[model samples]
Target: MAKDRYAPKTLDDLMANMSSRMSSYVGKSQQLNQHQELLTQCVGATMAQKCRISNYRDSILVIEAESAAVAMRLNYMKMSILSDLRKNGLADLCQIKIQTSPRAAADQQAQKKRSEPIHNSRILSQQTADALLEVAEHAPASLKTKLEKLAALSKKNK
Candidate 1:
């Protein structure tokens, strides 16, 4: 019997094969993430959410802000941020660069849209309102009053 050349391989096997080729890229990504987290901690949650670490090279740290206002704010804190980074393990970091990127704002907006819950304003059907009224008649006084209010509100929607 001949071996199948097009057999499916396990994910682990594929990852193991690719690990050597991707190791440096993965390491660099992790380092950047760590730097980003450190920056967030230094700047506070609100400011951090508006900017991101774009790159770090030759002792220069590049940051991309969602807008010019954010970039200006980052520039104001550059010295403090630089010292903080140095104290936190990035001792060789020499300069901080802030750039405004409109695309960052768009990306943030898209993320907000994805995270926000979609609300569908659905009107109650006559059948449901009638059922609610029927139940309200037998419910306790407090619940009956609430149920009656709900049924009445549903009718107003129509």
Candidate 2:
């Protein structure tokens, strides 16, 4: 009888095999990093909570403010923000643009093209689908993140 060559007979052997397959991705270029940072900072600005960053390019960043007031303020403050980003080395590779309307309107339209059942995506991952169904059995409205809280509250009442 031949020995099972594929099986890891011990935990250390399994860990060693996994470690041999590992690789690193530590460094990124300054230009790409700067553009990403610019996008992030623009999204973190005061007006950004009511806004969304949805368009980016090698030299442009476009955002959509949720309100007219925010849009106006962002437009007025654009140059200052751009200067700040340049000073911080972000705008060196990225320019800023603020729009009052949604940049993701096209994305919303694409999503509208999706007319399949809501559960179509759920079925894509069988494990997640089963988990969601199992959770639904307990409380249809209870979210997974809220499960522990609900259980704790129930225990306290008992």
Candidate 3:
């Protein structure tokens, strides 16, 4: 029988062949890392801390922000960031896209803590109900309607 020359004969040979086959993927990963490093340098440490380069595709650099407010702020810096990327040899970078991701775990937990409803009580005293009604009388029409509803609900609870 003829020797199967293409078949790897050892684990090291197989690993070498596999790495060669994956070279393109490794190169692409390196390019992505370079782009991310460039972006971080361009945007500076503070702004970069709030966002990351999520992808670069079809000449667009997609950035992921921690929140919509941060995205908005990044949007304002899009042009400058693009220019900086080009200057740093990322001439293919033509546009900047800022996408908002959900808050990180710590930020979400802090928000939850801040928004937690008071557990003391939902019940309202007669005096508090009367106070709401009195405030409603002096409030603007729009606010008055809402306050009146609250006062009515408070009275019903009592």
Two-way TM-score contest, 2 vs 3, winner: 3
Give me the candidate number with maximum TM-score.
Answer: 1
Which ranges of candidate 1 are over 4 A from the true structure? 1-18, 121-158
Clashing pairs in 2: none
By TM-score, is 1 or 2 better? 1
Provide the overall lDDT of each model, using Cα atoms, as 2-decimal numbers: 0.93, 0.59, 0.84
Q: Show the lowest summed lDDT stretch of 10 residues, model 3.
A: 102-111
lDDT of 3 by residue, 62-125 (tens): 8888888889988998899999999998987778888988656357558788999858566877
What lDDT is obtained when candidate 2 is compared to the true structure? 0.59
Q: Which of the numbered candidates is closest to the native, going by highest lDDT?
A: 1
Go through the candidates in order and give the clash count of each: 0, 0, 0
Residues 32-94 of candidate 1 have per-residue lDDT tens digits of 999999999899999998999989999999999998999999999999999999999899999
